[model samples]
Target chain A: MARSQSQTVSLADVADAAGVSAQTVSRVVRGSDSVRPETRDKVRAAMDDLGYRPSFAGRSLKAGRYSSIGLVMLNITDTGNMLRLEGITSAAAAEDHAITLMEMAPGETLSLTEASRRMSALPVDGMIFNLNRMVPDFREFKPLPGLDTVIITMLEHPTCSTVDNDQMGCSEMIVSHLLEHGHANVHFISGPELSISGAQREEGYYEALASRGIPAPEVLRGDWTADSGYEAGARLAADPTCTAIYASNDAMAYGVAVAMHDAGKRIPEDVSLVGVDDSLGLFVPHNGLTTVRFDNRQVGLWAFRKVTGTHDMPRGRQHVLIPGTLVKRGTVAAPPSR
Target chain B: MARSQSQTVSLADVADAAGVSAQTVSRVVRGSDSVRPETRDKVRAAMDDLGYRPSFAGRSLKAGRYSSIGLVMLNITDTGNMLRLEGITSAAAAEDHAITLMEMAPGETLSLTEASRRMSALPVDGMIFNLNRMVPDFREFKPLPGLDTVIITMLEHPTCSTVDNDQMGCSEMIVSHLLEHGHANVHFISGPELSISGAQREEGYYEALASRGIPAPEVLRGDWTADSGYEAGARLAADPTCTAIYASNDAMAYGVAVAMHDAGKRIPEDVSLVGVDDSLGLFVPHNGLTTVRFDNRQVGLWAFRKVTGTHDMPRGRQHVLIPGTLVKRGTVAAPPSR
Candidate 1:
């Protein structure tokens, strides 16, 4: 009754008012079934009288579980990243857990020690690393002492679970499709160097061409943006011999399409184009962009499950790669006669 | 040294091992400068020996500050929502705070009581409601007892700070621009009925038309997706008198464009088209879409600041509206002579 307006009422205050022990008050707060109905009612009334608000931190500290998952993303602006987030969030919600989103500053790369330190300070039971950047060495990257971690990367860690789309296979499928269309040589618009998926995709591009006895053209690097794709496309458009192109992602492919249009080149008629991630469908109605369709949301969902230890792989660390399907739209065609 | 692998090492164990008080060990774990260097080092060494990991929950319980901000979004898949998320995350990173993201399941509506209950249970100091749903009555929608709240909605509450784009102004700007293009009538594609921004934009459309002494056409309803826009566009395309069209958002406009193209009507030749949110720039290159451009990121940044009580308006609750600029592309032109 003598409490100041700014002062926070604690469990002790409610206990004192209810004539109950602090443990009993805590049990009531946690909604434990052990407490008698009368005692629970008394504590609830006292809590209302004291205007006591329960603290999740206090509850978590006692239970040793935060009921929250830490999501470390490199960036959220990317469509792929957003889709993954949607999947992760949906999974988390289904499991009655909250997602703590932590994004690295635009170009910040975290060392293992730094990542460990940061993750240890979070009030979360587990962490999901949705950062697209490649981990240089899994041997050097040890998991945090007490935190469960799931990395969304191409590289598999000895002690951590990994979730990723079949980056290499996606590129291989695209390249094979282009080759089937009778293109003599296919140029690739690669993603950023720091990206593990990008590197794997480029490797697949090389393997596909090498297998077919066709030498791959020099890669045009794009930063997974429409602008970057446009610049790469402009250079490719000038080369009359460059008949087919596989952009690493859809946004860049869209940029390439625009660049081709500007240079008076028709899609498929003059040069064929294909991209990964069938995301352009949402933005462009009847876009006819031939792309590799993989569920990024499934990757997020799997990553969340792995982090929470709710996944089927209970014994050993597993690397789950969701496969991509090549969706043939109007972009691919046989190379034009010289 | 005798501890089992399953047993957690508490502050008491560290204190006993270091021959110090539990409070001293706690101070060391919290990195408090109040502890002596030698004692701190001893406690830390004991913690290392016992494999003790500092619990953020314990720290938050003692400090009564979670150092987190809860972000409640209606959905995360929308382009507008994604942009806002980018802004909020960037701002949170700058402020050294993590974001707890909680999204309502698709088509799920939250009553004020339910919203308050959820907010009260989160381990966060404040909350940012990025839910775009309209609050039927602000009087009935009370802020959670002890949490700081900032809502992203058109309606303002007495106790809560609000952040929004100039929704009404955006529609007015679009309508006036279409009128200036010498169009007798401009048809509108409205967003979902539950959307606060959508309702305001509809009001602005009516106001703009009424002031100009031009009768407005029947509103075509859309759910903010490209697919829905296509459905609405098909209906408008069949009507010969529907010369000018304005979509509430860009995705719908893109759908409308595709529909018009399918109907063998050239954009700005047979029917002029315009949209809100210049989001198509990132997806489509050479897409001459006349639109209103507003920074959803700014709305996010402002909302974070408001929730944190770090905004410019310190004395009273305020509604912060980020203005939209009318961006002219090639979508609008004089109507074709009948």
Candidate 2:
């Protein structure tokens, strides 16, 4: 049978694209770290472009332990939780770690406590804990005690082995993306005003717009759903001068997209849009959603490795402040006439 | 500080509904084997009506090791895989066993192989092996040496501790539901026909119609996607007699709903609908899917318990079969002009 075009993009093509010899591409693709950055970037870029995604099993066999790690998104009720989880799973899978997921009843208080106890009773040595929705103030300190746990989400449980979006950093990135598109005015549609995610990301947005000497356009509220996003979009769409809007997550961004779509305003033409956590399932790539891609899968893998012996993290408070990369998929274009 | 509503529905409600004392309701709820038939039915009816669901975690601590047996589903893409997985997960969780999930890349054959190897390596004694998208010819079996592996799908891996759904049972259930609602002419939307889920469920639809001496409904193919269901629904909706449709999975049913919604028809009032697997997160539960709720979690827990226990199976060929319960919700009603 003929191989998929994605699967058939060969080692030779990857090597050629990386400007390295074929065997060298093979070594790098095999995940050998000795390759020079110039070469590594070439190979990685080539692999990413051609979608030369290595098989997890092949990688597992070669690496002894699969480059794949496990990620259990603590709950599902929170849309942000799923988005961040999507980030973790897709990023980790892209980085060649097969992500293993388990959804807990987010509302159940003791579920996580019990899940941690049971996780210790099972295999899969390392795991990134996506305690997204059920962030208990005192609960974080319990420390799935014996297990190596890396916490994701800003609501730091009592313990500190965690990785969170540079809330401030992300807001800055979106604002900067808007600024690059020549929009002096950029508004932030923050998540539920009470949430830690809302506060941190909002702070970043305010700082970014303020530092640039451009008045922050306006503060609008959203609850992280597409509906809330539509409301935010409707508000912004009503404004004659509003040019760029950054939603807290993709659902909101989708709502914004729908609202924009309804208003007959072409994206990046009438107004620019930016969303956090490149969520895969809900919105289509066909929508051309300009998003800040957080490598959640990588975050998950990195956290898992930290918990297990694969990746070393020095003791004391440590974190992986994974930066959000702006995905310029044609959503951000020049703003309309001022 | 109050317990969650799902966890704390009382014996009083059960008693009130059954028109009996709370003590009698409590005894019946406990599944005491010696209850009077009339009293038991009254109590059972009351429990079901009041949503007086059982609490597995509270009582099953008496069972020794792994009272909470998790069925780790390595595959996550296919709706069938998820349904069977949900069946096992729901069953196990209901039976007081925890369900640990693991979703692997279907694209990575090696990862899948490695995942099976690792799943076998896990401490879980028994499990429902749902071959989501992978079809097997029962070739060289990867010996899952010790684990009581319940091969759920038709993919013949080396099997014991297996549970094949009563496909005919499900089909009869749906056909009966449609017939009860006065629809003699029903149409079918099946899953990937090569897979067991599609075949079994579709078979159920066919057998019921045939057994009733009615002509078999015209069948359409769907890959279990809302879009495919949309395509199928659009085609079906155009027909004036497309008064009844059976989608193979809840996702496809959702698609059918959207297509019907777009086609300007009320569900059940215009076209009575039935689907399999009351899937979670595919869409909001506004359309309350009338599906074959295969209590997968119980299956997972039971399978896990069976595998991990001292239960003796006569070495050669063995498997377990769990029944799928008919979950009648808002999807199906009498066909138009009935």
Candidate 3:
């Protein structure tokens, strides 16, 4: 590759232009609190004038660290995963780190050996796994002996940092809200069978029902897709006893909403609906589906911090839980009188 | 920084295990088409058994190409951008390439000087810019002097390859559909004021109206968001004469749909609606809004090929336009009785 070598400016050049020492320039670039505002401004001005871009390549070489992170993600056409990617990217940029992405197709698992091989090949200081399904044996894949690794999952790997939303709490909130809306029976629409989050959410649903002394209803399984939700909705819509339903995610909620519409049933009128993740608001502002808002961005951000050793967390394998908030939209209402 | 060397397996081990020469093992690892299937299978089996991973660091040293590409994208919370990223990632993986992402904050521009500096620093052999808005003077930034570069946009720049969906053609097909559905004037809900796609869409809207001898309605501006769409939809709902609306993208269209629903105006019954991009189907499954579908994945794939120098083209500032298809659903209809 014939790269342009014309605009390369060193820290010394910026320091010379700003009438400061190279150490002072480095301190300013590093955003040290000790640097006076006047000196910082001067350094910035000099950088702007000379178009000095701090090269991570040179810095990493000196520091003996790659200053790069690897994100291993499952291949899915989910907007949620993308949002997380955006979060990780932005956070990495803020910390002056780069990302090397390794994506695998759905159902294709990166074996322990494969991950180990990739870790040695990639010149990254840390790794984050943005997987849809929780890997039970993730702890076994110790790619680098002391490499900081973070996993975005519900299950807590005993030897790896975990960043995840409080799935059980989110599920409880949705179910509790539906019960408060005067719905006698709140049927549950769960995610995939083996999904750790799905299992946690179902447990939360049971806990909500158990606390209220209401018997747990049968759970409907969905693959976290609108089509699956639609299929479940069709089945539930046909059952007259099914009034309020709580879906695992917003995509499935949209599917349920569609199936109800196709069945000539009005939302919140015939069957009140609630879903986890307010992403529905982004995609279907018109649906007004009541949902729980969990920021996947926060999950991504925390994962980045864990891998980069920035967060003031415990040294051992840690689990960071992001709380979910209830976003009351138009979808939930008091159940219709029989 | 402590890396484990215990699990490292050399190529000689795999060659010895497979009863093949080290050169034959290398050819199989490189995915050379010349290697016999039976020999390739034997080497692959040996690799799987021994857990031998080929290090790109060593391979690239001999190949003289870093099998990595940089994707510079605008930082925004758009699902469409994520979808395009997924496309690019999957395509890159197929070709055994890694992606280094460089995301600038929303409303922040990657200046010519900054891009040039980053290009020289990044270890990528090529780069792809996945930008939302058309850069007015994109030609000014020539980052890599001789490295392959691809831009996903409608605007043509000399000395760079451009891959994009035909914005005007997509808009025209949508507008013509509304006009054919008996809409006297097709009102356009335009994107941001400075958007290149917005400008192109608005032009296509005007062209459709002009061809039918009907004056184009005043354009309603949006920031490519649902809230902006909702505001425009609210304003249009107040006007009894406004029958058909063409939103530049699906998010805005969703916002418009919500506003119409809130105002008790039935979609396609009181006012017809059409939007670009079938992403509306994901969020507003029940609304069933008519839209145009453009394969952004194809754009990502082609961009990757252009950067890797795999595409067979006559070089020099190529413009590859992806075609769009009209997806007619429930939202579009003839204008209400006068």
Candidate 4:
């Protein structure tokens, strides 16, 4: 049975039971400096007997700061995104700050007003927004008043603090390395159409080929999954002109590798491959797929520092890039002699 | 430059500018029915001019309930855990309850008192604890007073509402299916030792073996990673006696599959394989691996319903188990004739 209203413990009831005034009970509950130790203990015991629960909302209202930060993301299931979150959480822990994660539904975009309402309602000193995709409408990305926010995306906004990967540079390195291997006809399996990294990498591919006087080959778009890569690979395998393939990410590269294997083409023997963002390195050390590597953790750490630092001393907008490196595993080789 | 004290907005400033009492300003900020439309508009405009930001903490203290719910987890990187979380967030959204995610450091455990204190400090109506591992000390698992709590683990505790998958039943189905296919000996790749689901599944495996009058074979342990599974597979590949293997989860199974492939062992033709969970289905079609499938989404949805329902009704403890089904694919087959 539910407890009756009279049985519900209140500050006045605790005061009456402890033989103290309501103001004294309130001071005890709030842990005020003026309460005597003996009186505090007596009040606390009386409150415990009556099951008096102090509201965190009240205490946090008085404290004004929770020493916590909110990380708002569209999705956490993505490995790259999750790794970045791991970096942020680890860095936040080092700084004695806790993380409050808010995730959007799959493929759902929240309106600016809703986002503002949620951020305002959160008991966090600052917030970090990890928008994997570009906001179509500029106004939708506006910040909530009084909340310090940092954006983590591939794009650099003029009026916000951002920590992101050098995608254009990373893409250029991948394309240059592939071209240096004498692969004139390099087919590209790009990420989803709306992806900022995809567009940058595609531009890099075109720039490399154009600089070398090689015409841009057909580009197959993938939805950042291995299955999409495999489908693209199947289409490329039928074309002998596609002697090499550059996949946007490692998962897609793995899919392409599988498709090539099923099509009776051996890696580095019949077709060479390259990929970006080597999260696959975690599960498979001898994966033998060449790819670009970057410290996503550093990006996250930098973002945390920027958000928390700005929370203390509000600063002007700044943009920082965490660079990428080429990890040459055995997946790259000179184009097969045809 | 940081905003000065004079620039910092307060409720009193809004009240004074609007020519209303502090209580009226508070009501307007809280969107209370007591505030007339004209007064609310005046207060809101005054707040805008004075840049007064309403304190969610203060408003929540007066309301005695925060619309948000806390989801406390040990790790958010695990795919299964993340999928379950996806289920929870989706369900919570439908019910208009926002979620605040609290993740413990990777592989870190907090004491009961610490966990209680953290939950108490959060402005959440209730909390869901998704502890993947079983607590060694019973006292450590005790629920916090005055906070409605739900657990998402296989253990059936007396004081908590729990939503869990039937691990033992799922394991039994996998073992029974493999044995029915005329495999005389089935090696097992078990999950981490401390995992509650892992322990339950191992027990089911032994139960199936004993029921068939077959002695239990050597059980290889993995830390629930594909890399660990690869190491285990490498060890088992050398043992010709090992014909069939049941991996604890799909990622580990995928690793074993890769190891066997590298070792020139044909799946089903040389060694039959089975895995638990079908997260791989997310990426691949026609995966050719036989396994058990359960709606982790359902477990998450059920947990959210239980938590929110209890929040309203303030009910007693309830235990729920979502069952699993065996998905027949090509991976399981009769052992190759010597």
Candidate 5:
């Protein structure tokens, strides 16, 4: 959706809402010392309510340089985000651009209005809003917020500038590899339902089945953890129809492998399997898992460049899709039925 | 090494060497504007040569409230560092502090003098330096460099306020648990020798063995990856003299499990095992990983709190040691011979 020319709110409107002087809000926006914490918080809340957007001219005149970039995420508990940030920040550092990482809870946060106010106050150049699960439809960190933003995620929201590994593509490649190896009707074990990546990957699994003219069997659900994978695998192993299985990530794949072994199914001979993220985990020869591999670090590198506009950005919303390839090891092969 | 009063380098000397004005050098140290990139570089290089220490007066006068906390990681690629930072940054967000993460290569960076110059120039209110490996013995981020700093690492030097997990105590608890269960001649797998956490855990291992009057068996080393664990396990399994195994991390523990399985030895039933850091790897089961479970997240929380001096920093040099308990699982038990 295009920005509404008429609906763009001003800093004065936010100043009016907060019952504070416009100068105080301006000081907060420019990161000046003249404002108090209580005043800043109040202005932030008001800006969010008013959908107040900072114009580049106004921001630049007050703050010397809007050269810093923001890398926003919902959760920091996952190593994936940290690793991705490593790649991005290192790249940013190499270019002498300071990165400001902002951790925000999507949807669960105190309304989009309030969130926008706080986000607008930060003096930054551009941003990378990473949505591990949920995210907004556009780069509106809050309404009418004007800044060049790139979203780093698996979600295929075509309207935004994003740089991430192709989760949907990885899913297709995973299933096709198994099907090509003579496995029929592949079993699917997925990550948490709330994840946008998980949903897209699931969709890819079904689409691949349809493309191959093979009927999709019942899919086992998982929470993207090894524990959840084990639970799902236990159920899959009990059924005779299950010949091959695919877990969304390597952790879950490990769980499924153990469950299959416990159930007395010889890998590939009885049940072929595949996983995502050819993690450092699969180097264990006993559980040498065959899966898809992609460099998330490279995704991070591209993300930094795109967000910073270090060079010319690719045209048309700019979704830089990194591909994941099937890494054939001991896990995938023809089913016994073949 | 103590600073010699007469031998101490002056700011004027540094300025002369860098071919910059004294005021220009001072501006760079305080991170003020009006300094050119080329001039800043020159000043930094000159300061590095003279071992110049920046002044604190200007910095102290400027910093009122901590807007950002600096996090200096030994290596960004280390997954433990990643997880620890995630905890630290998340906790920091709640406290209304922005994170400035610096991926520094202390050894490879410009001379320590220049390194000092670069760091002194960075204007962070407080900092968390996670020294995983053997780093410069500066004792501080150049020893206070004019701000509140907490070294959240396995630093042995008696300098800045240190806050680290009680790994030494945790290891003993784990070893005692294994020994009490009747395992004798326990084999140990360690992480990189450079890590203080690894060294502390090793110290605990040796102490437990020494007190119990058991001969110290040969040590196998790992880089804390699952693959290294497999290699270490293979070496141990090849030696029929070895029985119970303890790895530095869960990933390596899982590696050892795989190696033992391949070596025709059963887990617990044949070669009992234990690990530290409870990092639920792809192969390590929750109950099967009879390892020390410590709240590694607290290290970050404490570091963040201390750096911000949030609520008076509690008191003392504050060497916090979190207790680690064994999650009695299937991995550890008595040796078959016992």
Candidate 6:
């Protein structure tokens, strides 16, 4: 099948067919509102007759702007990633700009050379990198000479702007809340050690305990999956002193809850659970599992704004950290008497 | 900031600077591996010195093909939508094609005219419309002259190819399972009335009941939310005769589970519950809510293939329906004796 018969058709050909100037044909092709309805109809009919198709590439070459943003994400399947994309898309739509999305293969780390290659090929005015994996050092990560770039990561870059949630603060808040509830100590279920956010949260957990003169206990590691959380919870459930548990994410916390239930330990009455990310609120509803909520969408929005130079803040490598709110629910309670 | 200094650099200029022919410059720009290492370095240095950046748009115009696909989604926030996007992106990346994403504003429907406009402006050879709402008449929905298009919906368009899960079959399987479990009649918590998938599922529910010579009971409406399912579950809980419930989606099914718990009804004992879309499996592991699972990712991958004309099928409008599998977890059981 013929994909496009208009490959050879030019603006001059359309203009000649429509009995108009090339500029008039160009205006019609660009969907300019200034063209008269009758004139536009005549030009469209001429285009159809000549098999002329307008191309966004031609328009971009002429206007020097693509009116679109490129988004580099590790994956869109994660709940946090989806919410961030929603925010970015909403902002782009409001600005009348389109979004070009690119996802890295699972377990793929984006290198500086690959990033530069993608930026050069992408027909976008700016790009937002939402990859959670470790990024190339900002000093060495030079984007295409002219493309504006922003990264969503826990670490601040010296050149590229950054946006992230306050991961450390979220953990500190969870630990303090558990401590304030009079628990002797809060056992931790940490996320993967390689994750930047996970490392920050773990640091905060230790810092919060240190500030209160409580020695840190052993940390159970989880790969941010519910099953991993379940395994960790089983170990915690076997220890009577583990009355309070903190999982790095909501999925893991739900797993811990299930493990506790299977062990015949009632929530709050026997054990208190808290997690980061209030993602399970939709499924669990009124059964509150105390957790920290981050507006990842806001992070996305700010990243877009920074990349596009649309934000009110001073330009040049700005770092914006969105704070997480601690949601108190039914999970935390005073420790049971020994 | 100056966006692109290479706007004025031409291929001829780069060739002159590199002391090579225009063809050689073009070959280097395309990242062809045929050039000698020393020659490639010379060309690269020339390109950098002349501020010559390779543009995908320029390459597309020259090759008469855009190595990109346009994905039009209603929203990416939904769990199903995100999964479909993951599948599409994975397929696209594997094929070395970029994805340009466009999202419709909430409450906004895509009219044929609007669709035609988007198709014209998009620099993509093909487009996949992942909108769940009602579409225009297939006869009137003409895409830009030769641009390939695919729609993901319950209904089929004579002109545009389509890929969808068997929504009706999913519901039928749910009803059949409940009936086989010895329930008198199944009560349905349906999705929004205007949703195409919702309508098809509801029809299947009725058809399955009719086939079994069982009259359809009162239908409880839900907007595909857990809260709406909770409301419906409360009404069903008040009537002890209503022992079996089928929620159109898993979110509502989870809500129903919560309501049953509140009412002190043991799952599969006091009430047998089934839901479509095993989405809650991530959060509520092992506590089986017997649900139907559709491979939405497969639907998305097939839709991408159809739109790009890459699938090994006939070169006309074709419909592909992915089947759903009934996963009997822990929620279904024999109805109690009246």
Which candidate wins on DockQ? 1
TM-score of chain A of each: 0.85, 0.63, 0.78, 0.77, 0.75, 0.88
Ranking by TM-score: 6, 1, 4, 3, 5, 2
Question: What does DockQ come to for candidate 3?
Answer: 0.31
lDDT of 5 by residue, A1-338 (tens): 22233343567777887888778887787789878889899898886566454553344334444456666777766656766777887787677666666667433553333443344345455667666766443433432224566777765444557778887788889888888888767899988888877888899999988987888898888988888888888899998988889898888888888788788887878888888877746443364789888777788888888767676756456767888778888987788863
Best by TM-score: 6
Cα lDDT tens digits, model 1, A1-338, are 53333466788989999999999998998789999999999999998777787778878888888889988877788778888999999999888899988877766656554665686688788788886765444457766656778888877778888888998889888988898889898999999997778889999999988988988889999988888999999999999999999999888998898888888898888999998888765533364899998888899998888888775646558888999889989888999987
Q: Clashing pairs in model 5?
A: A48-A113, B48-B113, B48-B114
lDDT of 2 by residue, A220-294 (tens): 889877778887888888887888888988778877876776677878789888898776332322445788776
Docking quality class, candidate 4: acceptable
lDDT of candidate 3 at residue B286, scale 0 to 100: 59
For the predicted complex of model 6, DockQ is 0.45
Give the top-scoring candidate (lDDT): 1
In candidate 6, position A109 carries an lDDT of 62
Candidate number that wins on DockQ, 2 or 6: 6
Q: After superposition, how far is residue A320 of candidate 2 from its true place, in Å?
A: 2.4
Model 6, C-alpha of A2: deviation from truth (Å): 19
A312 Cα displacement, candidate 3 (Å): 3.6
Q: List candidate 2 stretches off by more than 4 Å.
A: A1-73, A76-128, A134-149, A154-161, A164-295, A309-318, A323-338, B1-72, B77-130, B134-147, B154-159, B163-184, B237-241, B253-294, B308-338
Judging by lDDT, tell me the better candidate of 2 and 5. Answer: 5
Fnat per candidate, as a fraction, reads 0.64, 0.05, 0.44, 0.35, 0.26, 0.58
lDDT of 1 at B61: 85
Which of the CAPRI classes, incorrect, acceptable, medium or high, describes model 2?
incorrect
Candidate with more favorable, higher lDDT: 1 or 2: 1
lDDT of 6 by residue, A1-338 (tens): 22356355779988998899999998887789999999999999988777676777777776777888999887678888899998998888878788888887876666755765675576788888886777665457766666878889888777788899999889889999988889999999999987888888999899999999999889999999888988999999999999899899988998898888778898888998998998874535366788899999899888888888775757777778899999988898988889
Best of the two (3, 5) by DockQ: 3
lDDT score of residue B109 within candidate 6: 67
The alpha-carbon lDDT assigned to residue A327 of candidate 2 equals 78
Q: Report model 2's TM-score to 2 decimal places.
A: 0.57
Tens digit of per-residue lDDT, candidate 4, span B201-320: 899888888988999889999977888988898888898988889998877787788788778887877888888887663222245678888778888888888878834634778888
